[model samples]
Target: MLTRDEALTLVKRHVSEENNLKHMIAVGAVMKELAARLGEDPVKWEVVGILHDIDFERCTGLTDHTLIARELLKGVVDDEVVGAIMAHNWENTGVALDTRMKKALVASDAVSGLIVAAALVMPSKKLAEVKPESLIKKYKSKEFARGASRERMVISAEFGVPLEEFLTAALEGMKKVADELGL
Candidate 1:
């Protein structure tokens, strides 16, 4: 398995956009929290989250997203990590959501965007200013963070976590790395 530092370095090599990098980091934080809650390996989940979008910048289309990442990460990370990455975009990549990690990855990926958007809209523009309740309120508004898929965010519930609890975990996770996210 790749260490977190090595995975981050590899991500930086592929992702040039600052927001994109921050998004990946935020997702990794959420994945770590989710893994802890579900009794999974936090380091492995975090690394998988960080490397999920390793081909985000190079991909030509939505369908090509994780497909390219599959090749980019081949032999560098374990099959489970790569499979979870591909499963996050399963609709496009045709990967099965056969594990809790894969389902959590999808929710984490979408929720990170919502949490960041919520923080940005706050008066202080800080992660500390955004609470889980506030996130739920923002989530109710379909117009808010439209890009953050509401459907995907609810996938956490499919794995036994309630929606609010999942959102809280995600917010707490992102709060731990607020400075890195520039939130």
Candidate 2:
């Protein structure tokens, strides 16, 4: 498996936009936390999360998103990791959400955006100020964080984690890398 440091280097090489890089890091943090909670390999999950959007900036369109990732990460990571990465963009890639990691990636990817948006709206604009309850409230309001898909986030519950618990985990995970996210 590709190490987290190697994955970060790869992501930095591909994704130049600061916000896009932070988003990837945020999802990685959430994936690490989710993996630890679920008794999975934290490093592997984090690497998968970090590389999930490896081709985001270069992809020509939504349909081309994870498809390019499949090519970029061919031998660097395992097939399972590649599959989870592809599955994160399942709507366009048509990959099956067959594993817990895949499901968690979907939830982590979406909730990271929601959590970041919530912190940005705070008076201090910090992750420390953003609460899980606030995230849940924002999640309920479709007007808030329109890009953060509620449908995708609901996948956490499908994997046995309650919505609030998943939000809490995501909030905690992002908080760990608050400086990196500039939240």
Best by TM-score: 1
lDDT of 2 by residue, 1-183 (tens): 788899999999999999889889999999999988889999999998899898999999898889889999998899999999888888888999988999999999989989988998999999999877888899999999899889889999887788889999989999999998877
TM-scores for all candidates: the values are: 0.97, 0.96
**Against the true structure, whose lDDT is highest?**
1
Q: For model 2, what is the alpha-carbon lDDT of residue 54?
A: 89
RMSD (CA, angstroms), candidate 1:
0.9
User: Residues 108-161, candidate 1, lDDT per residue (tens digit)?
Assistant: 999999998999999999999997888999998999999999999999889878
How far out, in Å, is residue 39 in model 1? 0.7
RMSD of each: 0.9, 1.0
Error of 2 at 46 (Å): 0.6
lDDT of 2: 0.91
Q: Which sections of candidate 1 miss by over 4 Å?
A: none
Q: Where does the lowest 10-residue lDDT sum fall in candidate 1?
A: 86-95
lDDT value for candidate 1? 0.92
Model 2 bad stretches (over 4 Å): none
